[model samples]
Target: MSMPGKRVQGGKQARGRAGLCQALLSLLLFTLLLLCVPVRAEPVLTMGYVEFPPFFFTDARGQAQGTIIEMARKVTQRAGYQLNPVYFPPRRMEKSLAEGRIDLWIGLDTFELMAHNTLSSKTVVSTIELRAYHKPGKPPISHLDQLAGSQVGVYFGYSYGGWMKRIQDPASGIEPVFVRIRSQAARMLTSDRIDYLLDYRGPFESQVDSNITGYLEYETLATYNLYFVLSRKRPDTYQLMSQLENAWRQLKREGEI
Candidate 1:
């Protein structure tokens, strides 16, 4: 007769093998289940932008539509991120970006703006031509100094590539008339409320009344490259920025940018 102890040992060995096999099989099934489940993407980002019509603005139907809006959408989508745009006044938008309430800003980048808990993308978002507008009969402005002693209308909160410093200096003698919207600047210029109105020419053409433009003369001040401004307040700030840069590169390569 066979030894009972030996038989029990064999049975233990068999059970041990079965247990291990079952464990491995369960692990395989769990991994397969995980593979079958879709991986979730990062949360939708809040893109903060000012109302620069034809660049970024809410239309008559209350829907945000514009070149910058479209560009932001493409970049975010390509990077596997969904964008939710929120309108903010210029100052509020800057503060929101610093506080991480707004994840991204697509606009002109400046050293002063980048100092506020923000980093700018290497990829150029767009190029904007800053122009100074005055009445047709007025003397043309070839330089900022020419406008000295005259009131120059400028959009509030716009960096204007730090030319704002020169514009605001007492010695420059430029009395700045700050307006909230481009339309206001256009109106002020047309009605002779201000000596000159400074604005980004691209949007000013479409946003301002055509008739008003006919009566005005403009000279290009400078062109600035728009960049993607990312907030430093978020943990994934660098990662998101990298993603955006990569997406921009791919789009550029494909000529889709």
Candidate 2:
């Protein structure tokens, strides 16, 4: 009877040990799972873009919408980043990019832009033509010199084939009336506020029947390929750039870029 009683007590002790061991094993597995789980935080990329109608512009709903906007959305989203678009004058955009306030800039290449610590994507996104438009009944501006001393309506943050900087110089004798948006260029020209308005040729002619009209004509000055410039000094710039390159390559294969 004593031996049987001892065996029973041992059995209970063994069972308790087994139960404790099982509970410990479960706890270990739970801890392992917690360690293995990945933390996913989608990084937000602040992108700087100027107003270029038919390509980049604000819709009536006050949302930025255009071809460039669509492309940006796809590339950034696929790269695991959310895009935050910011509008600024071309000069200020460059400054903001250099200062690390803007993470990306979408524009044509130039020595000035290249001087910044940025990485240009391997793909050429698109081409834009710098064209000058004039109102009806006026002689067509066949040459740039024709309006040496006249006021030319221009957007604040766009590169007019480097002509913006040259003409903006005091010695150039050409007056530049910088407008906040692209829509105002056509209106200012028709209203005689500016002698000629500089705009992208393709966008200016894209209008089926725009709100502003007066037998407008334009002359193309120069065509430039636009590129996506990533900041070298900004945080997570390299990772974002790598993602951009990957997205751009895939897009090229699909003929989307």
Candidate 3:
């Protein structure tokens, strides 16, 4: 005959200890669950875009959309980053890019452009052919010699290769009229304000205005190998470039680029 209440008291003490152990084990599991969950940091990149047809532009809803914009989205997503697109005027694009105010830009033909703080990706994203437009019945531009003393309409900040140097020279006799937009250049050509308007093939050929298309004849001038660039003053610049190259190559393989 043991003490009458001793067994009951022992049983209660054991139950209480088990309950405390269970509580501690549950807390440990909760702590482990918290550790297992990843806390993702949002990496952000600012890309500079200009309004040029078939590339990237702001739509009526004030949102950026286009083939180029879509590609940007894909590249950034693949890189585990978020994008903040900043639109710049053609003339201001390179300046912004060079100063690191924008981390990336696309369609750069001249590799040295924005050379100060910019590094181009090792991938060639696109090969673009530049074309010249003149009013119908105007003589074809077979060579640069034909442009002497003729007024050629060009967009501001556009690079026309060696011809640009000649145009800039006062003695070259090639009168270059700079316009802010391609449409303006086309309109100038249609109105005989200029003898020629040069731009990429796709945009010129797809002109929505009949008058501009009906009056223009085209000739291929140059082909440019364009690349995307990363600003040196940005964070994770090389990493972003690597991601961009991989994503771009994958997209190209899938026919999405």
Candidate 4:
């Protein structure tokens, strides 16, 4: 009883609806695929350091340049992270590191006494001798007791170790004049204001060129290890430290160190 032309029109309409449903389903499937994919987070790493030559220092251009800086960049890059080196003078850097203002601090000596609990990643370097610089003709103090009566020059708030601390205590016989800057200490030693200036031998030798060497003479007396310190409270500290230690060993094996 239905007309042939009406039947043909109904068939076309049904086909059109079926095509639209298929198109919408295809779009929904595509959207679901996009939602299931993961997005990558940006890689960022913050490093803190003080001005120590041949390890971490400001070059003539005022940019941080040193062997450790280069090594840090290489290691972080391999781990898919970027290095953001922040330079602060020794005291300020220590404060910032304690406050969690920085992620890592390089060239930290093993004996640094921090108020906060800090974790060390690995031994990055070693410095032999807390060397003493004196005038060319002065007798070197080979024994700790020899320095007892002298005014020793040290960087302000710097500590060598428990042994040095005990020796340096005023209650003990030795009295030292602690200076704020390395240059100041050196100048004081040259001018005879202080009997001697104590510093790490490696950096001291590397930084003091021939022009400056004429006024200073050095003697090595103690040794210590340097390491990278991280805030123990950071959740990523342990994992990152492990990764760094592994990377460091690999680099050493590969002669990159």
Candidate 5:
């Protein structure tokens, strides 16, 4: 038979081993709990825009409000994202978007010369016909070539299709003048400084002050579609684009677009 002191010593040793095993099991359980838990998501996204009235503009509340804004909110909501829309002048907005400071922008037309690395959604909106705005008494321009010898004002950094490129060529004979902003161009048109202003129909109608409308006349030239542009610099760009496209389609099907 074992001595009593040896039996006592054996009992203490067993207890010590059992205590170590219990401690290790507790540590393993705690680690497993940590691994199984889900992490919280971050809320962050930047959207860029230029001040185009009726489509997008800052209201009295200092919030971006317009049809496009509504559409964007719906799409982003579906993706569990929020938009931090930044309003910049047209040229600066384009530059910021190219530099990766902004995640996405609306009202960007699909053009070959523009920053094409961006992923563009199928045309979500369509622009009314392009028009020439002039003082009440001026002759209308029926053909593109008729624009020659006329001082035409266009928004700076805005693409008016291949027409701008052609106009830029010295041999094209069209004298195109680029204004800093749409409001400035409207003012110039009203004052009869420029012979003509090339603009889309909706903005020309909605934004020009009612008092000035009597002095100006717009004639439709051509129509085009507008697209939502997504930055390629952002991760999961393809997935994001897909989500947005689906969301927009759903909205359209529901007659919300």
Candidate 6:
């Protein structure tokens, strides 16, 4: 009777020890599983742009490529965010950004954007030199007054450094013709449909055909600084802008941008 009681007590202790060991093993496996799993990435920020080569445009393989696009990617990554570049037509790009359908835009800091309920970065990420291109036979332009009495082909929806008002004034004798795309403006000039084509030098250098460029004469009209524009409609608009601004400053200091 004493031996049976001792054996029963031993079995109960053994079962309790085994249960505790199994639980410990299970917890270890669960912890290892968590460590092996990857953490989710940060949310993506949508970058809006129109085709302005050397600043933002699509390559032949349909990949987004340009100076500002490259900078934006680095800045967003540094800010713990991912970037998703989206293409829009010139007019639509502005509207989408204003309505907050697009989160950010990398372009000129303009007065019109102020009324769009947007905030712009203080960092001057880039600058665009507006240029007037004419046929080689025509005299090179050095001043805005020289464009008087001429039909100038310009990009639609562009401010052109607020020179539009001056160009459109009846007393100025300048007639403005608008093109939806830069390529159209180039074609119009090359085909002699317009007296002059006004565009940016950087874009012309990046996209215009070599043969076409040889036939054109260009003059710098104005230079405008580019900034990151954030739409006010986002709930975290101020916070997002602050993150981007900090990232940009850091990148500048690191000489990475």
Candidate 5 regions with alpha-carbon error over 4 angstroms: 1-43, 111-115, 181-184
In model 2, which regions exceed 4 Å deviation?
A: 1-39, 59-62, 111-114, 181-184, 202-214, 235-242, 255-257
RMSD of 2: 6.6
- Residues 166-243 of candidate 3 have per-residue lDDT tens digits of 677878778888887666777788789999877787666554477667757888877877688888888777877888
Alpha carbon RMSD to native, model 3: 5.8
* Candidate 3 lowest-lDDT run of ten: 108-117
User: Model 2 lDDT vs. the true structure?
Assistant: 0.77
How high is each candidate's TM-score? 0.79, 0.70, 0.78, 0.73, 0.74, 0.79
Backbone clashes in model 4, listed as residue pairs? 129-222
Number of clashing residue pairs, candidate 1: 0
- lDDT (Cα, tens digit) per residue for candidate 6, span 4-44: 99999999999999999999999999999999999997999
Clashes per model (N, Cα, C within 3 A):
0, 2, 0, 1, 0, 0
Q: Model 4 scores what on Cα lDDT?
A: 0.73
TM-score of 1: 0.79
lDDT, candidate 4, 1-257, per-residue tens:
56998999999999999999999999999999999999676487788877777788888887888888988887776666788998987667777777678877765544444545578765555444677789888888665667777788776646664356766677767777877666666777778898877787656667555556666777777766667677665778888777667777777789887
Q: State each model's CA lDDT, in order.
A: 0.87, 0.77, 0.77, 0.73, 0.77, 0.86
Report clash pairs, candidate 2: 89-157, 90-157
**Model 5 poorest ten-residue lDDT run:** 108-117
Best-matching candidate per lDDT: 1
Q: Rank the candidates by TM-score, best first.
A: 1, 6, 3, 5, 4, 2
Writing each residue's lDDT as its tens digit, candidate 1 over 208-249 gives 888888778899978899899999998988899999999988
lDDT of candidate 2 over 28-50, digit per residue (tens): 99999998999887888888876
User: Model 4 segments beyond 4 Å from truth?
Assistant: 1-42, 109-116, 122-124, 161-164, 181-184, 209-215
